[model samples]
Target: MSIVVIGSLNMDMVVRTKRAPEAGETLFGQEFALSPGGKGANQAVAAARLGAEVTMIGRVGKDSFGSGLLEVMKQEQVHTGYISQSESQSTGVASIVLDEEGENRIIVVPGANVEMKPADIEALESVIRQAGIVVMQLETDLNMVEAAAAIASRHGIPVILNPAPAQPLGDELLHQVTYLTPNETEAGILAGIPVESVDDAERAARILLQKGVQHIIVTLGSKGALIVNASGSLHVPGFPVQAVDTVAAGDSFNGALAWQLTRGKTLDEAVRFANAVGALAVGKAGAIPSLPRLQEVKQFLQEAAEAEPGAQ
Candidate 1:
């Protein structure tokens, strides 16, 4: 089955610092690195590396960064036939600062990503029609995201919306989403509740459900994730790992979850698998480079199981 990712494509510039800068103040960083990372591209690469057939639908500029982004997609085996290039705009970019503790702060410049319009999604109707699942994030224009969700809904294809960099959404968009995955902070913003614990996440998820989203998964960082639906709420624990950089952990989780769901795994199984993927990603340092391959994930899971008590 094919997965379509309709989102942004950006080059990430990361700075490793001892701590984030205060307002009106600056601090020297220890190191700097550049990598292919937009929420869309990162998720697409994560899924592709985990053996999913992924198609990326976004816009990039006709620049070196754009070229490098496309090259990364090709190397990851993600289909880039639907990706467009704009002559008027530069490629999108995210400037990120990571602290010694692995926490990060980011600022994104949409650039070419904002150039994606409903027309672009309409142009890829055939690709969306053939996809088993369509994954999206907030890096692109919200109008385009809504249009894509509507189109996928009309075609009866499942849509997984990860509300990253969370913003207010309308009922029309919420009604079209089959699954809504939001991290704690995002869920808190969308639901207008404090998502500090599993109970809080459940409450936030319930608010989303009332807004017409069918299923909700609120990721709780190291604590795990909360799964909520009409049936009830369930908490899936996260895998413990030493985090080096948390740049793409959430993206990896979303991608792996989508891939597992497409493979007919239950929500519990998918979340568990996604947790492993996220754990692996945070243990590394880059965005796309941190995503684990299918074999690596399987081996990691096997090792974790063996390390558990009372294993034969």
Candidate 2:
């Protein structure tokens, strides 16, 4: 299925350390490197690698980081025609700190990402109207996100909203989305409750359901994902893998889910495939570098099946 991602593009500067420092203390030990990231670009490249036709619609600065990000997306087979360059703004950046256990903390500077306005979404109306599914996130301006969602809604396109960075959302936006994917922290914020277990996630989803979101998916790191909709709720188990860095795991899941849904997979089937993609992502290090290709995911699942019959 053809997918369109409307979100942010960032240059990720990653630092690996033993563990996160305290309020005033500082400690560093491992390595530092630059990577291509931003939820939008990560998801786009992910679905593209999985054989979906994806177009990225976002703004980037006319800087080295922006240039590299565009180059990487093209290399991954994601269409870059819709991405625009902002001469006045510098490229967005994400400062990430990673611990030995693959856990991470991130601080983002929206930069050019936030420069995108509703006009930008209107300018690309035709492109968005043609998509099988339109994927979005909170890295960009809320108005722009709402604009794209409105366009997708007018055309009856499926809209997937990955509300990250844990912010409160309005009912208008929630009603416009077909799917709302939020991690434990994000779900907790949206539902006004603490979320740490499957039960907590389910309760939070129920609260969100009252707010008019069509479907709610709460991603629970190693515990897997819980899906809640008007009809009912279901939990899909995650695969066990040695995680190196879990930077883009959720992005991989969203990408894989969108790709599968576009290809006519049932919601359950898509979630299972996404779980595999996310597992593979956590096994690797960076954002874009961690996303698995179609064959890799197939093989991963195949091996899992062979190792433990019916495990996958």
Candidate 3:
């Protein structure tokens, strides 16, 4: 089975500090680094590292960042044939700040990500058609997301829409999504409720379900996830890990979820695997650099199961 990711490519500029600075206040930072990251690219790399045949469909600027982004994708074995170059826009970038606790604050500059036109989506029709699953994020143009989802829905492919950078979505897109993966904050905005706990997350998921989403998964960092569908809801518990950086934790979960589904795992099973992937991702620093390989996840799960004696 194969997965197609319709999203963005970016070079992340990251800074580390003891604590996040208040607005307009400058603080001394512990470190600074550059990483290839974008919600779409992160998901693609996460899936590829976990042994999935993944293809990325997006655009990048004609610059060094774009070149580096493509090279990293290739190194991760994510197919880059569908990635395009933007003549008018620079590659997208994200400014990220990580604190001592590994929490992050991000500001995104969409750049070439939003510059991708409808024609780009149209050009990838055939590629999307053959995919077992189609994954998308909100970093790219809204039209691109809808266009890809429409095609995937038409082909009977399951679509996993990770609604990051939370925004309201119409029913047409919601109805086409097989699974809507949103973190607590994103879910709250879509559902018009403040999500403060697992129970609150479920309430938000239920509200979104009425908006025509087939199933909704509300991701709770370190607390696991809440899945609500027409029939019922379930909570997939998270694994314990000392978080080094929470960046890409949600992206890793989405990627692992898609890969496990391709292998015929049940949604419940898939979410469990996804949780493990997310745990591992937060244990390391950086975005793409932190995603674990397939074997690592399996071993992590095995050890988890041994410790919990089937509770895993």
Candidate 4:
């Protein structure tokens, strides 16, 4: 089985500082680093590392960043045949500021990412049709996302939509998504309810169910995720870990969830696996660099299980 990711690719420029800059105040940072990241690319890398055959469909510039991004994908064994180069734009870039606590504030320049259009999805119809699951995010054009979802819907392929960056989507898009994964903030935006607690998350998820989304997974950071469907709801507690950077935690969860589901795991099982992935990701730093491989995640899960009482 294969997973197709249709979204953005960016070179992330990260700076470590004591805290975010004030409105007009500028402070010097402690460290600077560049890494391959973007919602789409990070998720693809996360899935690929977990043994998923992932094909990336997106656009990048003809610049060095684009070249490096493609090379990173290739090195990770993610298929990049569908990734194109934009002639008139630079590769997308994310300016990330990380505070002492590993919290981040990011500003993105869409650049070539904005060039990905609905036509791009049409041109790759065959690729999408051949995938076991199609994954997408809000980092790209909404129309393109909807187009991809529509294609997957017509072919009866399951579509996983990660509603990141918290944008308001229409019912047309929601109806096509087989699974919708959103953090608490995003769930609040989409469901029109404040997601402050587990009950709040469930209420918000119920609202999304009313909007036609088949399944809703509300990621609650340290609280783990709330999985809701017509059957009922399950709260998968998070794996406790000392987090260093949370940049790729959500992406790791999404990728692992898709991989586990494609392997025929139940929603509850998949979310539990995803929670382990997320915990491992936050223990490290950077985006793609932080995503744990299959062995690491498995070991972490095994250790956690054995650490419990009454083990064999």
lDDT of 3 by residue, 21-87 (tens): 9989989999999999999999999999989999999999999999999999999999999898998
* lDDT by residue for model 4 (279-299), tens: 999999899999999999999
* TM-score for candidate 2: 0.98
Report every candidate's CA lDDT. Answer: 0.93, 0.93, 0.93, 0.93
lDDT, residue 15, model 2: 96
- On residues 247-271, what C-alpha lDDT tens digit does candidate 1 reach at each position? 9999999999999999999999999
Residue 224 lDDT (model 3):
89
Give the distance in Å from residue 64's predicted Cα in candidate 4 to where it truly belongs. Answer: 0.8
Query: Which residue pairs collide, candidate 1?
Result: none
For all predictions, the C-alpha RMSD in Å is 0.8, 1.3, 1.4, 0.9
Instruction: Please state the error at residue 98 of candidate 3 in Å.
Output: 0.5
Residue 58 C-alpha lDDT in model 4: 91
